[model samples]
Target: MAHNQFELLKQRRFLPYFVVQLLGAFNDNVFRQAIIGLLGYMAIDADDKALYTQLAPAIFILPYFLFSATAGQIAEKLEKARLIRITTAMEIAIMTIAAAGFVTQNMIVLLVALFLTGVQSTLFGPVKYSILPSVLKPEELTGGNGLVEMGTSISILIGMIAGGLIFALAGAQGPWVAGIAVIALAVAGNLTSRAIPPVGAGAPELRIQWNPIPESVRIWRLTRKQLAVRNGVLGVSWFWFVGTVLTSNLPVYAESYLGGSPTLYVFALAVFSVGVGIGSLLCEKLSARTVEIGLVPLGAFGISAFVFDLHFAQPVASMAQGLTVGGFLAQPGSARVVIDLAGIGLFAGVFVVPLFALIQSRTPKGELARVIAGMNIQNALFIVLAAGVGIGAQSLLGWTIPQLFLALAIANTLVALWIFTIVPEFFMRFLSWVLVRALYRLRVRGIEQHVPDEGPALIVCNHVSYMDALILAASIPRPVRFVMYYRIFNIPVMRWIFRTAKAIPIAGAKEDPELLRRAFEEIDAALADGQVVGVFPEGALTRDGAIAPFKNGVERILERRPVPVVPMALRGMWASMWSRRDSRLGRMRVPRRFRAHVEVVADAPVSGEQATAAALEAKVRALRGDAA
Candidate 1:
């Protein structure tokens, strides 16, 4: 049974891993923020402070470039539970070295410790992502990822707060306090890692690669083998690029543009982090417990809209002195700015969770770790580039923070459009989802369990409305190649969507005999390739709100290629705007009253040999009941 993401916390396989990851993220931020705080606020010399503050992030990110390929190979070659324990132990050792640096107040030692922390994180990256598929069922991947993302975001916010508060309050003894906290967290992380249940090596026979460069190239090539995986990797990396730009600019933006102090900056961070957590939690509900990439487009649209709004929300001039968090909140337009920031974070959460889940769900288990490694490398490169661009824009071009936000808004649109063009399935899914969500209150029963997760199957449903295929496509968890009437498939706005979705367009025998033959051949090929094919047994929508007789075409289809047939029905759709409840041209035109309640029922799959059109039609009618 599907349960809330939080319920997984009670399970043995997920809870320990979740705690370890949360601690790991917390520890990273605490150290990083403390180092930055030391330079930004405590350092006596301006030049020394500026140089190290800039160098800190670079040092942390460098290991991902140099060692992630080797990390991926190690993860593939070793047992995941043992690997996690080893990496957590490494973190403990790194924190101990860091404590020595803090005690001596030596900058060089501290920098070395920072770099080592990055290396530890690099070694753990592949193991963290690749282990989920090994331990989780496919249907659980999205919810699992949502929890991980939510936990990581909240941990970062809390860790930064703890580091800043402890360091600021303790003064000279700040490093000592920070040092103890880091070591304690590291030990806790290690202990939690030990509690994770055992998982066998994903690729035990794989040979270890010693050279990072060639191995990185090899892994990048591996990602290109599947188009969906490649697109997913690119999407995730691009998200990092955009996110780094937005987040890294926050403090400066708050001070210069928003006329706010550090407290206000912290408030902004909290809002954004909480918003992201909220959005991540909402994915399971919005997708109906499925990993629906349709949400990706909605996310992208929201991100662009909110970011553009942020530019306009900023004050025209910087105040003489920054305002406190309370003062900032007292301003008239402050709430708008908060909404914009929260919206961006919320949409970002919506955008990223599914891409990560999709990559995990689609990638081959044996090579999943390496592909994730490749994605990490790309993410590193993009983040570095984003930093450079930010620096160059501010330092060389003299652009203000609002100008930067404007540029990012424009860049987001172009990037999202390019990615959607590369993967039309995302856009098609988006259109289907929007149509269903806007026009109907959709409810479904027995879909997740009965629908085949993978493999060829014939989906037989009663034809009720012209929008039947889109509704089914939106509701079902898998991508279905709908066998649709040629004329209906070519409907204006829906035509391109149908084409992009690869919906098979067929005509009746008298209308176009060649198209009929070709459609059947294509349907056979799709089934042979292990894809779902949906068909309306009645062949056309009923003129009245009643079940029509099943056609002989369904019998012909079953005889050609016998596959399991699942019976489904869309109820209460006959009165929908898209249906001919009145007339297609008269009162029931393009836009009727929206949000009509509709229910779809899916019954158990029956063997293909026994799935005659008459039997399937009767099943659908019974399932629909008095819905019309």
Candidate 2:
């Protein structure tokens, strides 16, 4: 119930991790940009500069492909806190070697340093992400990721500036400055890692594997076992690919396409990074602090739309030569380009944060690190493929950068459509989120900590409106199966959604005895499989604005399967357009624009043996109180 994420920074559990990650990100950028700057401008002769600069990035990324599997295994097999400390120590040693490379002005040594730094990051990757779920509660995961992402963006921006400044001002002393700065940051990171609470290994008994390729393949196979987790990982990897395409081409886009200077390029990066930070921070607010997968579709749409728009936003009048930062900003139609870039990053943040949270929450704890390792490998592969696509399009096909952006936007659309089709639950959740947000101003209380995060349970609620099931489905963080009257469940407009949610539809025993019997059997099967099933104990929708008498069907369900029953109440929905308060035509007269207040309060769980139909009806009425 904290108002903002900043309060997390004041606590020991999150603060130390935050500081360590921020510092690590800053160090990575500082060393990388510094090395790239030296290779591009100073250390290498003009003839060889291009080759070394191109080689630098490859060297940095190679470890992810070669060692991510082993790194994942290491994280799983060792205590996380110790692994973090060891990774931090490795960082210090790597930076020291980098400093020696800088001092001796040896390009080979520096490249080796880059490769080793990449290895350090490869090892750190699994630990950094896997530690989050252990350290933060389930509800806190999204917010924590948002903060880490924001810090990383800002750190990269600052590190780039610092690297640039060191190269410019330190002159011959640049190497020493870079070396000292990285070493100091590495030490600080190590200290911060020390303060992290102890985290035992997730898979301590697992045997270590030395072969990288087969191990990588094994882990990747494991990752693909879960459809949702696989899609989420693919989505995350695709984001990196799109990002690589954009970032790899930005300088060319600035200098050649937009006719802009280094200042202008930096300005563009700043806008994009800041936009991502803002969007990441906004996820908690938009989803009401839940891991709302609905935001993924929205974000994908925004990214596609803005990227497509960027193709047309290019200026008509060519400058023929690059412009100064200020000159570029002053040009006509430049604002649109800036907006497009920022929007791409903003939507990217929205797209990425939830997938990470989803992967963490859904993956088994034993395989969490290895799955993350697989994701890293996929991300690396995608980044390389993105580079290949960029090269083939621009060099082989003669496409302009704007043309490439358009192509990527189209590709993004296809990828999103494909993923959504493969997993319709994502689409269903998106519709549920939009529907509830549009019609009602919803307030949910006690579900965060009270509702079992994983288990079988029964939810008993007053049947107030046709929207009751939809509202509960949207509000609860986990998937829930609903038991509803066969007529309502089979409504032509809503049947598909009901089928998608796997809601069990029942008829009166006298009317359709077989259907009622099958419904109860299905409910029992669902509970046996550890799924939540929600039942409106009233057996039918309330005809008047009062709680209907609870039926004995709940008693039968409890007798069949003795699980905990949660009592809930719906308030302020009786007069909503979905309710049957007036004539059918009268109810549809005027649609509420939005912001109609409604509240769903869940009481503590009661034992199934003790929760009689009358007692539950009375409990729901008390929970509803004066509102309805």
Candidate 3:
């Protein structure tokens, strides 16, 4: 598939939908904050302010229960771009009314705005996800969805912080300013919405769902009908469940436990967001354009371990002290202690990105929109569960914030163990650790232990340097065939060695179609004959010594063979003799003794369902023991 990467970000396609979705999030937070701020200033004779605040998220989630069933169906059948325009326009009107309510200090009106924003989001739900499959290829879906997820999360954080600031800076009249900002955003969103590439209706003339509740139930039932649908939804819902737990409780922890100010709030969020963003991008860098579900379980472990440590780490600094604005930094080892939060976010990137791609790639064409709708319902329910846990821990058990962190960590571990045990691919991979403790030997982890001994497999590794393939071929007991770039196949000195190893040659799709054709035919034959084939998915040695996006040649091969994909991570090669690690590629070369420690760790054969480059890359990153 051609990379329309720049075009994907252009105003006509992805930008419109991004703007619509982002502005909607912005408006929702703005109106909610306006209500909360107003409630703070005017002491109404209501039952309890805390009570109302606690219930706010629940009220917002209610619409998912009420409208998502039909909304997804509507999204599948309606013109997506037009639907976005409608939603944006609705936000403008709804926010206008919210502003009026704020002016009159009407609590009831403000609450209505919360519910209305939920409704608007509900309507946009199906359209947002369904459109991606239309615009992207299998490989592009992971990066595309990753960008969207990261962007959406950042938008939410920005909206929340900005909404509060808008109010703080302006006072009672602050909400009016918020409303104006939202309205302008809403208009810009609608304009962009109109420009999106046309995505046709999936189920044209499908019956309009008059009853949202029963219909919603019907779709939830549909999700449970298939193993793929059920497991995929469960995996996706876990992200929300994990997210809701952290976001809901942190503020209270910052206030009462840390005795922290708003600055601390900003710091905590920034750390988590940056960590997750880094993790998500690493997926692309490491996976080399494969869906690396192996990272999902890896993230699960990190989430639990770090969160557990955070639990133990917290009470020490927090025992007698309240966190001040300065305390965010002042606490001893505060940065490391926050690893749990960052790990949680980073794992979130690992966990969620592939699932989104999986859903897009796997969902039935005509039902893709409805499938996303099903996702929204489950996601909402899981978030509600997260809030419930936070509330129950806080109010019923009188649990402290750090204790809640401990509980969440334990729960995450158990859940991961259960999931992996049920699907041995993840567990089996973990069990395959080969601890050859020889100082001269390469000690491999994760992959070598997990790769199936039987069947034809394609091994993909990031091309960090020229020696990457040679090192992997030498270590793994099984003989492997390598697909190499034509340039390296003819290197003056390395050419004979390449021929002796029987490496395949590849050219650009247009550069040498005949060569590509022969390569494809050979790959297909190798898989059919149950041979193990290895390829430099990164296409060439990393010039800067970083991972590169995978070439489509591998994807095209998969479309033909659909064989078990064995993702391998070759570590220590960057420093090895045949590889380049610095600007001085050949100048300050090290001796062969320094290269003796290089290792190749091959992970399990990723399933066709989860064999995406992003998924595979995450697994390899862990194996490489790099920045991840």
Residue 409, model 3, lDDT: 89
- Candidate 1 — which residues are off by over 4 angstroms? 37-44, 134-139, 199-201, 552-561, 584-593
lDDT of 1 at 177: 87
Query: What lDDT score belongs to each candidate, Candidate 1 first?
Result: 0.86, 0.86, 0.70
Cα lDDT of model 3 by residue, 400-500, tens digit: 88898889888988888877766554432222211112222454554435554446888888776665555555444344678888987887746655565
State model 1's lDDT: 0.86
Q: Rank the candidates by TM-score, best first.
A: 2, 1, 3
Mind giving the per-residue lDDT tens digits that candidate 2 earns over 1-628? 3445777898888888889989999999998888866664464677688778778888989999999999999999999989989999999999999988877778889899899999999999998888888877667777878888888888988888787778788887887888898899999999899998888899999999989999999999978989989999999999999989998888888888777877777888888899889888877777776677878898898999999998888763246466887788778888898999999989988888888888888888889999999999999999999999999999999999999999999999999999989987677777877888888899987777566777799999999777899988866766689999999998886787787778999999998999999999999999998889999988888888888789999999999898888888988887675777743764653544235688888888888778788888888899999887
Roughly what TM-score does model 3 have, to 2 decimal places? Answer: 0.69
Pairs with backbone N, CA or C atoms under 3 Å apart (clashes), candidate 2 = none
Pairs that collide, model 1: none
lDDT of 2 at 501: 75
Off by over 4 Å in 2: 1-4, 40-43, 316-320, 587-594
Best candidate according to TM-score: 2
- Candidates in descending lDDT order: 1, 2, 3
lDDT of 1 by residue, 576-623 (tens): 867767564557544443577888899999898888878888999998
